[model samples]
Target: MAVAPSTAARSIELPAALADWLATHADALDTSPALASEVVPRLAGAGLFGAGVPEALGGSGGDVRDAIEAIAAVAERSLTAAFVFWGHRTFIEYVLQSPNQALRERWLAPLLQGEIGGATGLSNAMKFLSGIESLQITATPLASEQGGWRLDGGLAWITNLRKEGFIAAAAVTSSEGAPPAVIAFRSDAGGTERSADLDLMALRGSNTAAVKLDGVHIGEADVITHDARAWLPAVRPAFLGMQCGMSIGLARASLGAAHRLCTVTRSGLLGRVESLQAELARAVGQMHEGVADGRFKSAAAPLFRLRISLADIVQQAVMLELQGSGGRAYLMNHDRNFARRWREAAFIPIVTPSLTQLQMELQKQAAAAGAA
Candidate 1:
């Protein structure tokens, strides 16, 4: 029998221990790799890893909105940790709903419990070609004793490869006569290798890298979703939920910086700082409403829109904070709230579909709706 999607009770209230943990360790997760390692395990222990999973599968059984809120709270403290956790949770959710039962028991369960880390290998094999050039990786059946199939190709940019125990990747499986399929694989499995870490502009702690699978053996158990087209709809929404958390984190940091400047600076700049704070408040309120209502298609559209807006808001807020506080805000040792968040926000729009692509999609959607 096929496993049903989780439907456990949702825990909306934030536990006191979790709140205190975020407050105490947020800064550490940002600046210290050791602290991140420490915190990630704790987060998993606290059941935060299962926030987006179904209750039947040992998750909190919450909706995407709850996951967004929890991630936003985490990001407010540590964007790096939050980003990693968000990506991990998104992939874990994908595995939980996958058709492969053995894969779910071996990979998804352990991952949610924080026993293993997982990364996505799909982005590496993705090509933006308008038509036929879109897919870059292929999976071919292997003839050797290892059994299953072999994946031969690479993904362009993959995140969290260094730490993950398994990889969820997409590969075209075909010869001359068969249709292509997307597949998932374990990191320790034969034929899988991760390249050196990429020099990223933001989310440095993500350990993003390129992954190559050279005739790596895989079986039916490794396939998360055999039908790529059917999987896209679910994956897109989960990613959008994470982006919503990222925007909330960026906005919160920006606003916090503005508040700090207002409190420390001379009276002359207080009015401008206050205005920026109010604008940020409005933006955050809108974000909250958007997530809560399930509007923007489970927060994907709003998150994408907020990503564009957050980048601008963070930049402007930083400028205003520096102007209000003079050179103090620029001190290398001082926390550069706006600077870090602005840089992080930059990654959100460019990571996959990209801002330009999202805008064009929105425009096309509008045009299609008008015709309807």
Candidate 2:
């Protein structure tokens, strides 16, 4: 049976005022670095930085699906802002799921309030989790009297490394061969350095940067999980599920444009639009069900498939929008609507746990089973 959109899904609506603001400034946010860096505080002011978190943690009290919906709503206006939202919210999830109550209690309020940016510098960690890569950072235990570990390593690319202030999470392996540990530390911590923003074809204003840790001290309070191998699987669902929001929002916007153009122009493309929309609904429904029922937690292959499907659907949606709109969308209008989304769709495939990475993982799983 064709799975339907999850009836159990809860919708998260961005405030009309904030939506209007994003729509008006989406271009500037994408093009202007300064404007993009300010997106975190703006989202906090709109009371959306904590949409998916529990109320007890100073959040608005919804699940990860609500978080995904919130991101999609912002993405429909400005993907740059939504990218920032994902990084920040994903970090919040890490802290919320951490076994360390002290860490959660210390950081949740400020993070939820957007007082400090949350950089989920975990793309490499996720790859590491999948056995595709090893942990990037190394940890050395300090003397017994001076507790904590000194970390040295770097992340090639991470988002939400804000200038004002931020906290970042990373997985570090010790030379002693102990299991990798997931830890959080402030961006301003000594020996921690953030590079200038990376120049990109789009979303340049996303505050994306490389981070280097040189003898950075991480205390017991900073540890999210002592066993990254075990903990990562538990949180992987939320991480990937939230990332899918970007694809969802971008796809919906492009498809909506295509559908509208087909209607107004009496174009035959409406049938194709409807077909893609149905596929999109199925992907979303599956994601919703997986996240809610804990299916994605124990088995991530389906989630990976869903992520791949969404990326493909997003690209097709953008192409359909471009075709339906004809010459008008090709023009460099002030809004740059079609042009921006086209660039945004290009990003979907390359995002962490990218389509290529996920495909390889599926292949590995298949090969292992065949060998067995």
Candidate 3:
């Protein structure tokens, strides 16, 4: 008989510098509203932000698997930090996937070098393209001399830090039959407005906010794709793949907490925690397979299911900690102990491929598969 794999099987490791910073700051990140403008440069300087950038483009020459590992490591410590990295890396991945040489040369090197920081506002766009929601942001053709398009619209789920930050965003065309495009925008440019930070339950320190764009001008240098929907087909797998880090890391961290505290708890409670631990192991195994085989697209269904499973497991793991703990108040406090992880787990149900959204798409797929 074949031997079963270990639950602690991690393929790639985070750089020592990133690990050290996380260790020093994880408590503060968890306890306070950490500022991205202050935090991002440190993360970037530690080489944490460039894992998905390519070497030819002045990056460290890493790939999707490397990115996932690094992301998971951060998530395991502080979901706030993990969330901040996710938004930044999403922009990096988007630019890397683009065929725009001018865009890559102008931004990729500086972005990888930590000289600049940016947000990614494509979550809404991703949902629209996936039919989960309608498109909101838009772009209109500019005069020939302008050499690009004019943007007017808003994105609600972007992570913007510095006023000088850049963003990778999407917009529909003003004219029918004109393909939608994904473009880059500057945070401080005229016609760009950002809403005050939105209060969040779990990842409040992540700098999540809305961006309103009115006549924001773009040149050829800012265009990532002329056809955003078409563009989705090329990059969706990688986009979805990066999400694995968020779920896996969160689940692992919660489960690890439960494991530490369950040693002296009741047998029944311990059994329940053990069961959730087993489920987490399977989810991590599935993620590992996807990364190793480069089968994100083909493995999309399983990968998505694993995501839901991680969310479910995280809820149980945190609850188990509450049940097994003596410091019950800390476990239940909004900003303390396992309570924070509970709220963080709550986000999984609403994160882009939310539990409801995932179930809807899965049902749709099941019907289509049966008809075939």
Candidate 3: regions farther than 4 A off: 1-34, 266-268, 291-294, 326-335
Most TM-score-accurate candidate: 2
Clashes of each: 4, 0, 1
Alpha-carbon deviation at 247 in model 3, angstroms: 1.7
TM-score, predicted candidate 3 vs. hidden true structure: 0.87
The parts of candidate 2 lying over 4 Å away from their true place are 1-7
Q: In model 3, what are the clashing residue pairs, if there are any?
A: 180-228
Question: Candidate 3 residues 76-191, lDDT tens each?
Answer: 77777887777778778878888898887788767765566667777777677657887776677776786677788887777645444655556555544577778888876789
TM values, all candidates: 0.78, 0.96, 0.87
For each candidate in the order shown, give its overall lDDT on alpha carbons: 0.62, 0.88, 0.69
Better structure of 2 and 3 per TM-score? 2
| Per-residue C-alpha lDDT of model 1 across residues 320-359, encoded as one tens digit per residue | 6567556766675776554565566556567565666667
Rank the candidate models, highest TM-score first.
Answer: 2, 3, 1
Whichever of 2 and 3 has more lDDT, that candidate is: 2
TM for candidate 1 is 0.78
